[model samples]
Structures are given as structure tokens and as C-alpha cells.
Target: MSSAPVIGVAVLLVKGETVLLGRRRSSVGHNTYALPGGHLEFGESFEECAVREVKEETGLDIKDIEFVTVTNDVFTEAAKPLHLVAVFMRAHLADPDQLPQNMEPEKCYGWDWYNWKNLPQPLFRPLETMLKNGFSPFSTELN
Candidate 1:
């Protein structure tokens, strides 16, 4: 049996005490908060895809990135079994003040900075864990 392959990239973008998050538009649980990222296109490396996705979804340029964790999850969406390979990375913005003007209006409803200590409930689970644990992807424990 052949399974459909999907590549997802997520960024843990931090600026001092806050982290950047975007609301997913078409997820099973709509209005869920997640890090800025998306799938990798053909001929693109994961790192390049990560940088591009952050810019496309959040209008921010990233640098000095470090690989975090990788996960594989199988779930059903829209009545279809979906298999995903998710890659998480840590990145820093050159200038947080600069916003990109070309974000998709529907896909990205809005952006916000949340204190690492206090995050809203029902955040994208993995992202929340990353924030609460202080950005160490290599560590196994959630500290």
C-alpha cells in the first residue's frame, strides 16, 4: 500500500518574552493557533522551505536557525487518512517590526505575540510545549 506523503515545517520564532503565532484557516480545528510554517515544495530543502514559509505566512525574515524535533503523525482529515512528516525549527527575526504586506488574507487571519509564560488554551499542542519548555528541541523532557 502506498501512503500519501506530506511535509510540514513549523517555526518557533521568538523575540524576547514573546513568540509569534498564526491561526490556521483550514485545519480540522479551525481557529487553532500554530507557529508560522507550511509544506515544502519540490526542489526545496527543509531549511529553505522553513525560511520561505515563515516569510509567506508571517511576513518575517528568519536567520540563525537550529533544528528542533521531527515527528510523524497519522490522522484523518476531511474523511481522508493523512500522513505527515513535521519538522520544527528555531529562528530569530532580523527586525520584528517589519511586516510583510503579501500575506494571504484568509489563511492568516492575524498575528500575535504571546508571553512564553502565559499562553492561551488550545494552542497548537507541540508549539505550546516548545514555548513552555524554553526552546530546546534536543531535550527530551518538557522542563
Candidate 2:
């Protein structure tokens, strides 16, 4: 609906060989698996946004947040045509033994850790695009 593309911060919260994700309950990507993130707030740095979003959505704190990559996604087939510039970031769990909880039930079904080699079905657009382009959060080299 908006004329300009919205900026989204997607955190690849890693733990060993797995990453945290949640099934979206929102209209934009309903039923799709996605990372813990949201729109980048005005004047907020990428790291701050990633940290805040993860805690707000998953009730898990993250650390070592670093920029990974970006994806320019345009969902023309969606019910409402949409464009998004997704900024991907990599991070690790602040507490290694801490489990993730569904902090925002209204927006996400729940959070879980899935192996990077085998992800859940029906991934969110930006995530899918990133995978298609071979962007791996576990790797140090940027793609």
C-alpha cells in the first residue's frame, strides 16, 4: 500500500548448528516461518533493532549481532502488493541454555530452533530469497 519500500531487520539468531524462527501470524506472511525481527524503527541502529526485536518477539536475548546481508523482496503476488528491503543480521543466544518462548502470541505462533541444513517449510519471502542466494548465517563469509 505504501509507495516506498519498508526496511525490515531480520536476525539470524544462531545456536550451534541451529537458528531460531517463528511461524508468523500476521497477514503479511501468515503461516510462514521467519526470523525474529520487525521493521527498523526510525533513527535506530541495525544492531539495536535486532536485539530489541528478538527479545520482544522471542523472549530471548541475543549477542554478537553483526550485519550479514540484505535482500530486496517484492511480493507482487501477495494479496496486497508489497515491497521490502530486508537487512539480515547474525547473532548468538546470550544465554546458551536459555530456551525461547513465544513472547508475542498475537504476531507469531511460537519460536523454535531448526537446523540450518534443514529449514521449515513455507519460509517467509525475505528468508527464502536469502537461502536461494546461498546466504548462510553460520558462515563467517558474506554472500
Candidate 3:
């Protein structure tokens, strides 16, 4: 038997002082806040997938993507194993005036921009750490 294939993508979209976050509406961790992203389709490159997912979920066009970190989340949901490889990327919006449009009404409740100094409670740990620690734009990637 073969191991499950690596899939999924996550993005860290930043403006000057705020980061974008979305409230998930589906999956095992529904209603939780997560970075904007989703699964990669066949024949799509990671970068292309990232752009597509971000647009589809958040309705924002990402420009100049810089690779960041990788997160592997595997857990038992209802006694079945779920494996995900999340490719985290740092991207800037083409137009800061634009706002996130909730396309998947049932899958994502809403979107918000939180200041780096005042992030909401119960945030996704890794993303919180990234904000608190001050990610360097000059850096290529994070381990």
C-alpha cells in the first residue's frame, strides 16, 4: 500500500499592519480561524495552486508570492486518518483597497484583518508565532 499523497496549501497575506484570517466552516476543524488556502488540483504547480486557492477562498489576487514555511497536519477525525501537507506562502495583495469576498458561504463564515500587535485570541499557533516573532520579508523561507 502507498502512503497518502501530499496536498493542500496555506497563505499568509499581509498588508502593512494587518494579516488576513478566515473562519473555516467545514472539515473536522470547522469554525476555526485559519490562513486562507485550500487543496491543490492535479497538474497544478504549488505556486499556481496557492494563487488559485487564495483567490477562490478570499477573493483576493495575490501578487509576488514568497515561499515561507511548511506544515504537516495529520490527525484522526472520526477514527479515520487525515493527512495534509500545507505549503505556506507570504503574498501581497495587488490592490489593498479590495476586501475578501466570502465565496463559500457554508465553508467560510467571514474574513477579518487583524493588527500584528493585537491578534485575536485562540489563533492558529504557528501563524500566531509567525506574527509575534516578526517574520522577515528578506528571508526566503522558514523551517
Best candidate, TM-score-wise?
2
Question: Quick one: best lDDT, which candidate?
Answer: 2
State the number of backbone clashes in model 3: 0
TM-score, one value per model: 0.78, 0.96, 0.80
Task: Indicate the TM-score of model 3.
Answer: 0.80
lDDT of 2 at 77: 74
Off by over 4 Å in 1: 100-102, 125-143
> For residue 120, what is the lDDT in candidate 2?
97
Model 1 — which ten-residue stretch has the worst lDDT? 134-143
After superposing candidate 2, which stretches have Cα over 4 Å from the reference?
none
**In order, how many clashes per candidate?**
0, 0, 0
lDDT value for candidate 1?
A: 0.71
Write model 3 residue lDDT over 44-107, tens digit each, in one string: 8778987998888878898888778666666455244566666778889988788898877788
- Assess each prediction's global lDDT (C-alpha) against the native: 0.71, 0.92, 0.73
Cα shift from native, residue 10, model 2 (Å): 0.3
Residue 105 Cα positional deviation in candidate 3, in Å, after optimal superposition: 0.9
